[model samples]
Target chain A: DVKVTQSSRYLVKRTGEKVFLECVQDMDHENMFWYRQDPGLGLRLIYFSYDVKMKEKGDIPEGYSVSREKKERFSLILESASTNQTSMYLCATPGAGGSYGYTFGSGTRLTVV
Target chain B: SQQGEEDPQALSIQEGENATMNCSYKTSINNLQWYRQNSGRGLVHLILIRSNEREKHSGRLRVTLDTSKKSSSLLITASRAADTASYFCAPESGSQGNLIFGKGTKLSVKP
Candidate 1:
């Protein structure tokens, strides 16, 4: 089975602290995405990368940034964490064989105080 | 704003009963997909139905799409307690494969 692994399952950070969330996929997919899921707003894409060293902003990329230094890994960065930035962060990649659908990793729930 | 909207924010049903959820979208889409997320977990892709396909099935799950109405429905037959989770519908933008997801329907199956 294809797997996307998130480095952290839960995190707590002080307001104004810099934070990093990491993800790695083993399927050799060309695409990776980062999203933040909130109660009523659903999952909003923060950023997505279709190739190493290339990234694109998504619908809700204002407070977040991403890096794809390697083909199998993508990272999300919060320059200065705030209360409103606390949410469940998800990482996903398209299934193998050029499918448009995705396989997601277990999420990282971040809590900023 | 998201492109899709789902009905019945929450639903509860007994095990072995069927559960249904609906989603509506505002614009043209290349395909519609259904996903399930367990509490505190990432989403799992359940099914995908292209705009041209009216219906599709996998295991006990059935999905129907109506392009004219810009809506779709997902049905889970003989649901189990394990099936309790939040279900989301995503419509892929015609140009890019990027998906806009709807607020999910949380379903609870009691044993």
Candidate 2:
């Protein structure tokens, strides 16, 4: 089965600290996405990359940035963590074939205190 | 602002009963998809319904699409406790193929 592995399952960081969330997909998919899931607002895309070194902002991109130095890995960065940034972060990729469906990482729940 | 807005923000049902969730989208779409997320976990793709297809089924899950209404529904027959999760819909529009989601329907199947 295809897998998207997240570097951390849970994290706690102090406000104003720089934080990094990592995701690695076994499939060599060119497309990858990062989203933050909240209680009622649902999942909002922060950024997505269709190729290495290429990225685009989604609906909500404020306070977040991404890195795609490699094809199989994508990373999300918080310039300076804030209390409002505490949420579950999910990394996703299209299925084996692009656009058929999606495979998502287990998610990293970040808590900025 | 997002496509595929779901209603009935929450639902409660018994183990042997069926659970139905609805999603509606605006503008044209290439396809629509449904997903399930367990508590504090990433989403799992449940089913996908293309624009031309009216209905599709997989295992105990049935999905229907009405492009004219720009809406879709997901029915889970004989839902189990394990089926309790948050269900979301994503409507893909344009060639970008990026997904946008609204508040999901949280289903709780009681034993």
* Chain A TM-score relative to the true structure, per candidate: 0.95, 0.96
Q: DockQ of each candidate's interface versus the true one?
A: 0.69, 0.75
Candidate 2 per-residue lDDT, tens place, B1-111, comes to: 347899789999999999999999988888899999999899999898899999999999999999999999999999999999999999988887899987899999999
Compute the interface RMSD for each candidate structure.
Answer: 1.7, 1.5
State the lDDT of candidate 1 residue by residue for A1-113, as single tens digits: 78999999999999999999999999888889999999888998899998999999988898788989899999999999999999999999877633337899999999999
Please list the residue runs of candidate 2 whose C-alpha ends up more than 4 Å from where it truly belongs after superposition: none
Q: Give the number of the best model, judged by lDDT.
A: 2
Q: lDDT per residue, candidate 2, A17-112, as tens digits?
A: 999999999978899999999887889999999999999999889999999999999999999999999999999998875335888999999999
lDDT of 1 at A85: 98
